[model samples]
Target: MAYRHPDRETIKRILEETDTIAVVGLSDKPDRTSHMVSAAMQAKGYRIVPVNPNADTILGEKCYKSLKDIPFPVDLVNVFRRSEYCADVAREAAEIGAKTLWLQLGIVSEEAAEIAEAAGMNVIMDRCIKVEDSILLPEGKTNR
Candidate 1:
């Protein structure tokens, strides 16, 4: 059977319950979408973990070289990497016991999604978390 993302209500629940987000391929450059989106999430009180090998810090958080390097438990693995690299990120997120794997807008990898689902991780693909959060939990109100 084909895979389907969680329903709108489920997505809202995930957003409300999740606190920490590990962003893979996060860049220090402010112009990048990854940086901008992460910044927005941070403003909403979500802890952002930068996972990039080239950077030491981003958005005032220490950058981890990989998902496995994060010291604390990650509630969500928000990937900014390309679709080709997502499977690896999914594996790492699963290995580290992440509760969710979120692929940014324009990124969709069936293999990665399957891997994450098999590991009991919720998967969100081709959608922006910040947008979802805003739409689903506008002004701190759960639009359920």
Candidate 2:
């Protein structure tokens, strides 16, 4: 069966309810898409945990080497890695008890989505979280 993303209401609900987002593959460089997207989310009041080994910090948050390294609970696990690596990240996110697994635009993995869904995580593949936030939660309707 094909994987269907959550409906608009569900997506809006997830965006509204989530607080802390662990961004896997986030970069410190301002020019990178991961950095820009994460920054946009942070500006909109979501706490972003940078999960990149190459840097010590991004957006003023301490960088963790992996999802396992995050000391606190994460509401969402947003990934910027390639499709081939998503399953591993999904497993880690499940292990960490994250509520959602979000694959950035151009990234998709059926195996990852299956694992996450089985673990009770809401999966969103091939979508930009920043764009969703802008489009779904316009004019501060669900800004928190």
Candidate 3:
């Protein structure tokens, strides 16, 4: 069967519930999209955990080399990596017990979706988390 992303309501709920997001492939450079999105989310009251082997920190948060390296609970695994890398990220997200696997805009992987789904994760592919948050919770996470 074909892959199916969650609806608007579910996406909104996921955004509302998520407190910490582990961002895979996050870049330290401010000009990068990953950095921009993560920064925006952080500004909106979400904890942005940077996952990058190269960076020691991003957006003032400690950066872990990989998802398995994060010592605390991550509510969502927000991937900025390419499509080919997502399946591995899904497994790591599952291993770390995250509730959601979110592949950023223009990135998607059926294998990644399958792996996350099998582990009972809410999968969101080819979508930007920052954009969704802006549209759904326009007021920011002020109520949270």
Off by over 4 Å in 1: 141-144
Per-residue lDDT tens digits of candidate 3, residues 1-144?
568989999999999999999999999999999999999999999999999999898999999999999999999999999899999999999999999999999999999999999999999999999999999999987564
Task: List TM-score per model, in order.
Answer: 0.96, 0.96, 0.97
Q: Number of the top candidate by TM-score?
A: 3
* Tens-digit per-residue lDDT, 50-140, candidate 1: 9999999999999999888888999999999899999999999999999999999999999999999999999999999999999998776
Cα distance off (Å), candidate 3, residue 9: 0.3
Q: Which segments of model 3 are wrong by more than 4 Å? A: 142-144
Q: How close is candidate 2 to the true structure, as a TM-score?
A: 0.96
Candidate 2 structure quality by residue, lDDT tens digits, 33-126: 9999999999888999999999998999999999999999999999999999999999999999999999999999999999999999999999
- lDDT of all predictions: 0.93, 0.94, 0.95
